[model samples]
Structures are given as structure tokens and as C-alpha cells.
Target: MAAGKQVMVIGADDSEESHYALEWTLDHFFKPFGGDTAPFKLIIVHAKPSVSSVVGFVGTGAGVLPIVDADLKKMAARVTEKAKEFCASKSVTDVVVEVMEGDARNVLCEAAERHQASILVVGSHGYGAIKRAFLGSVSDYCAHQAHCSVMIVKKPKTQH
Candidate 1:
């Protein structure tokens, strides 16, 4: 937490697109100018879906709740580790990683407000309009709800 530096909140998940967003942010914002001492304080947030939300109806899957919960916990750990490792690899170790439980849309917006962020970065999943309508878009919600400016980093289509 560097004094006088603006805070940047980056939304991370167990997705390749999110990793690209992290890498892209480091390269463009932290790498070129900041080096070891970045101008902006970085906070990486990973939203863990609530067990009930993941279980949905939970009738037939009720018995597997424990299993699902364990899996989710493991995933969260992996996400946090990956984020930390990636930041370390880029020599940007002055980072705060948060794994909160809730919907990503709300979690990211809350993080931006909590940290008084100057910018919020998220990866675009590139879902079609129909799919986005049904699945909802975290990036879209954050763009409109976050207190600070939002950056939706879309991975190159050819990269994968």
C-alpha cells in the first residue's frame, strides 16, 4: 500500500482470459514505467461463487454439497496462487489478493469502491449477445456499476 499512489483493482478468475488481462495490465501499466515500484497499488480480486448459488436447486446434488464446496475452495486457492505467482513473475509483488464469496459482478464493484480504486480491470469472455443475455456479463456490470473507470481487456482471438 504505497501512499499517494492510485489503486487499481483487477478482477481475476480461473480463466485464461483473466490471466491475459493480468499480464496485459502488468506489461502496459506496471512493466514499462513502474518496474519494481509501480505507480498504482494493485489489488487482485477473485470472486468465489457461493455454494448455494452453485448448487442451485440442490435436490439431487444436495448430497454432493460437501464435494462441491471442497472443489470450490481448491479452485479459489489455485486462482489466488496463480495471481500471486504471475505478479511475482512480472516483478510486481506489491499486490493484495482477495478471494471473496459472491457473484463476480458485485464483488468487483465492491472492491473498487472499498479500495477507492482509480481503475477496475476485467477480461472479456467474448460471449455473443444471446449468450451474454442468458449468462450475464461481469465486465458489463462492472463497467456500469464500479465507482472508477473500468478496463475490459479482450484477449486476442488468435492467441488461443
Candidate 2:
């Protein structure tokens, strides 16, 4: 394995599957690559809902527009901080946390391109065949749309 920095973009959200994918990434890639020696330039991406979706909620008042924008910024900061904290706990030092405003599919692919990521990682939510067909899985979309290699990590199903 090349003992050099590799850019990896991971699509994350406030979901159990997203967290599991992070853990899987650390265990499978970072740990096996001799930890900090190879140095992974990780980019954690979280996509917030489209700002247009919340426009009506904020009303057409000009006075509080800045306030609404500030609120959005704060939410992005919180998401970035959470991702940083989680990556730090996993011994991932070189990490960039990004919170983007858009749908997950487009945002994730755009992030990978902007970051020049060598690989993109996403998690499977384990949606059923019918649901996946209709709802469209983010991981599946990333695999098809990402600029680089993609890994779709699925949580193991334990037999009861």
C-alpha cells in the first residue's frame, strides 16, 4: 500500500447507518493502513436540506433574513464540529468537515469533486427492495455519480 496521504470523502448524516460507516472506515482503512503513518485526508460531508425548502418558514421579512442565514451557519458549524469530534476520536487527524446545502446525492458528488477525493464512502440504510427502488438509496446514487471510487458499507445483519 502507498504510504502517502489519500483523500477520502465520506457522506455522513445524523443517522445510525452513517455512524456505522464511519466506524467501518476507521477499522477497515485507517487502522489497516498503519494508522497515522499513511495519513488519510478525510472529508466528512453532511448535506442539509435545501434552503429553498425552509424559505416559507422564515417568511418574506427582510429584517430576519440575516438571522435565518446565521441560524443556518450555526447548524452547519455544529455538524462540522460533530464530525470533527467523531473523526478525532477515531484517530483521524487530517479531516475536513463540510456541511453543504442540497440533496445528499448531488452534494456528496460535488464534495468529492471539490476535494479531489480518491474514494467516496457511503452507508446503506438497509431499505427493502421495493423501498430502495422507489426512494432511491443515497449510497447507490453516490456509487453511480461520484467522481472517484466508491464504497458502500452496509451494517451486518445479525441473526436473532
Candidate 3:
């Protein structure tokens, strides 16, 4: 939000890979100098899928709608809270966290455009070719569709 500082959008979720990306971004871009101020204004975006999307056309009926919606809401809240807590632990307080309802690829691209971001960061799940083809990689989508530069952080397999 500060003048002269470009915005950086980070796509986060309830996954260790996503958390790794956030940590990588903070270390590489925000914590280098151990300064409170970062070169970019960070905007963390978490995509929360809608109940209808989760339910699909299975026709499980209205009985399952409320429960599914509640679960989704709770999950979104947890993701955002975890992100905020991680940032706090890193001593990075200047950030805006948002939980938008939609698919991750769309939500991340939209957040970058909405924030006029200079860069968008997302984590890679390191899925195999078949899995990626089936799941439709969100990072791959944003890399091509986003208006700004994109960074896909891959967590090392042996980092456990």
C-alpha cells in the first residue's frame, strides 16, 4: 500500500508446500536485511472453494449444503490465521491477508490484478505429469494467465 513499493501477491493454502512458499518469499524478499520494511507490499491470498463447487452435481441434495459450507468457512479461516501467524513469527507485520471464494488459479490471478502486483508467488506440489494433468496445476495456470511475473517455489523433497 505504500507509494513506490510494488505489491507482491502470495497464494497460500492449508498445505506445507504453500507455507514453504511463504517462508521462501519472506526470507528472500523480506528478511534479507533484517529490516521491518520490505521492498514490496505483501498481499497474501487464500482461495476458498464454494460449497456448490465442492458438492458438484452429485445431487446429494440440500441436506449436505449447510455442513459443507460450514466446513469450508472454517477451513478458510484456519488457512488465513495460519498465514498471519507465520508472518508474525517472521516479524513481518506489514501485510494484507484475504480469503476469496473461488478456484485458486482464478483467485490468485485476480488478486494480483486487483492489487496491481509486480509479482505473484505460489508453491509447487511437485505432482507427477499425470497428476498435474488431472489436477490442472494452479501455478502453471497463473504463470501463463497472470498479468505480472510469477514465482513458483518448490519445496525440496528431503527438507523434512
- TM-scores of all candidate predictions against the true structure: 0.94, 0.79, 0.95
Which TM-score value belongs to model 1? Answer: 0.94
> What Cα-based lDDT does every candidate model obtain?
0.93, 0.81, 0.92
User: Which ten residues in a row are the worst by lDDT in model 3?
Assistant: 32-41
- Candidate No. with top TM-score: 3
What is the per-residue lDDT of model 3 for residues 1-160, given as tens digits with 9 covering 90 to 100? 7877889999999999999999999999989746358789899999999888999955568789998999999999999999998888888888899999999999999999999999999999999999999999999999999999999999998954
Candidate 2 lDDT score at position 79: 66
lDDT per residue for candidate 2 within 73-159, as digits (tens), equals: 777777678777877787777777878888889999999998788999998999998999997889888888888999999989889
User: Where is model 3 more than 4 Å wrong at Cα?
Assistant: none
Ranking by lDDT: 1, 3, 2
lDDT digits (tens) for residues 1-160 of candidate 1: 6777899999999898999999999999999865557789999999999888888856546578898889999999999999999999988888999999999999999999999999999999999999999999999999999999999999999955
Q: After superposition, how far is residue 88 of candidate 1 from its true place, in Å?
A: 0.5
**Backbone clash tally (model 1):** 0
